[model samples]
Target chain A: MKWADIKEKLRWCAYLASEAYNMPYRSTVARARREQDDLFMLLIFSEMMGIPNPATYYTLELQPIMLERFHDWHTRMGMEHSPLDGFRCC
Target chain B: MHRLFDRRIIFVGGKGGVGKTTIAGALALMAADGGRTTLLVSTDPAHSLGDVFDMPIGNEETPLGPNLSGLEIDPEAEAERHIATVKMSMKSLVAPKMYGAIDRQIELARHSPGTMEAALLERMADLMVDARSRFDLLIFDTAPSGHTIRLLSLPELMAAWIDGMMSYRDRSRRLGEVLKVFSRDQSKEDGFGMIGGSQDEPDDSRDGRIKEILMTRRRKFHRARELLTDASTTAFLLVLNAERLPILESKKTLDLLSKFNVPVAGMIVNRLLPPDAGGDFLRERRLQEDEYREEIDQTFAGLRRIYLHLLPHDVHGVETLREIGEAMAEQLGGAFGAAKAP
Candidate 1:
């Protein structure tokens, strides 16, 4: 799948995880994306798990570069797509 | 004498990798040599007191100088001790069959917010209370600024929570007494002991005594806070390098301490590259050092700035610590008032 599609899916997963965990939706989505390394893998994993917050172990292992890429993807997606796009997954 | 070194608690904290422990060691040496019974304690989870002193520093106090003692609190050991105390307390109160479940809960609570650092602080306060006469000064080689703030503030937060719990216990006792009187049974007296833990029950008295001891600990916390805030009794020294990160972090720390009403006594600029003797690299380092020295002076006005030359070897063992003590004294214009040639 394309990186953009993967990031979109990851965003959706983050939204779902935040809702499930009763965390602030936007904050959890930010935290989830901030924690991912490869935008493509983050998207793929989010799509597969259908939940966002990444597991605790994954969060702990996250690197700065991964977080940077995830942030770039998130920013690009935010500009092009509706902010409400991920809400349906929740 | 300005009584500069008579401080009860000397906190050495700044960004990591800035020689905080080394400076703390030197200060402890000076305090000890000056005849104050000083205890140098490290609250940092990443223990370096052993490495700094070149001696084993366990939970127990170890004498370093004529009147100086050192302690490096092992967080894991402290956490285990905390868990054991909690488990024992729970076992004394609850049913025997439920002790196992309560122990698990206590273990979980051990990792709860602020428990590890708080336990360390409590242990430190307990040490001070027990050794009040033995030691006149407690020098804390605190962790980096953030962790140190949390550790220092733990006492105030814990004290407030304990006070609230004590009030709740009082209310519960009153309710229990009322319910027992209405029931008109001898078992009602047992109910009185349930909440208040009456004189009749030895086990209850043990728990009650623990609570009383904890309440009594409020004075120690108050004393510690006073020692921290009063300029006469405490001196919080910030140890920093000329590097950008440490300098910026020190600035923020100074601001935070001011916000908390903790008086910052001075700043120690450690590991400064000496002015050029020969090499181009040394000359360039000296230039950077001059620039940062200017910045530090400008930023932290009216505060005494002490600069120590970079040493060839790592600061370890009492010999090196003594050398550092000499350097520190000269920089601060204390006992050993003049800098000696290397």
Candidate 2:
């Protein structure tokens, strides 16, 4: 057998062996990702929280794409219900 | 002299009721008569360009003469229009399911305090950036003193804000990339057979879109600031009366303008009492006027000053503006007439 072929088979076996076990860091990575998303949304949408942003008009178009995550963000920040839950058609 | 008319952009500002609109209109007329295509724009929410011209000018550009065009931008209307345009652009980008909620948020933003000023400044910056190629001169009849200063300074403030946002976005993006690598490695260890497809990173379309929008605004503000602070191209004319209050206000405003690197073109002492009035009451008023004029000359020393007589009637219509323009032309003389650019 060629050296390259032997190396490739060994790597595949190692990957298959590692795949047999569960990982503990999965939940932590997910939480970090969510927090980053929340921070980004907050920077753009703080005008909605009664903070005056001069560039709010420019960011209005960003609302549609951010709408789905916005709900989860508000809830995670301790709101039992969405502020615009009544207007929610999604 | 002709130097004022030679500038690309001129901003006329003063205390309310000091005839800024009238002076701005006359300046525009003079520039146009000099064979330059001039645009006179009013940035006041409470517009009076129509009153000054004695013609019904709206929020859009209205031609007043062969070479002069006038635009009266209302802050409220401009804010609404900005919102509408943003919403329309979002129509194709935003999913239908989330439309109603986003629309409500945008409507609420319309009533916010800074939103109107932002919209107005954005429109002004747009004009400065986009209209540079189309007109020889742009004369702005600005809102009452303080508001106009704020409007003039917005480009710098917004540029700083954009810088902050841009850096924050870059940091967050880098963090996201790092976290993605970590997650991919963790999934690999768990033998999930390449979770998230291994090569497929999270969708960063939002970051790209936001960065594009911010970058465009930053460029506009950068150009606007450069144009505004370039003394060779921009001039700020302070219109004031010879009375104590306007003179004091003008002094403070001049200090503010120079401090901000805005070129102080000159001061126009509008509404001077005529010297030939033949009554004791008029004589007494003239004596006091002489004292104030002397003080004005002393206070604003070394600056080009123009003194104009108070007209018998309220200045209205194109004919009166032309007459005033001619009078101003005589006072300016032919000295310092060469346009200097460095």
Tell me model 1's lDDT, rounded to 2 decimals: 0.63
Docking class of 2: acceptable
Local error of candidate 2 at residue B36 (angstroms): 0.5
Model 2, residue A37: what's the lDDT? 64
* lDDT (tens digit, per residue) of candidate 2 on B1-342: 687877899999999888899999999998998899999999888989999898888878899998899999877888888788766765665567657766776788788778888888988988887777989999999999989888888888889988887877787676566556545544544445433234333347766877888898899989999999999999999999889999898888888887778998987888888777679999998899888988988898767777788888889898889888887888777563331110
Native contact fraction, candidates in order: 0.00, 0.31
Docking class of 1: incorrect
Candidate 2 clashing pairs?
A19-B191
Superposed on all Cα atoms, the candidates' RMSDs to the truth, in angstroms, are 19.4, 4.7
Candidate 1 TM-score versus the reference: 0.67
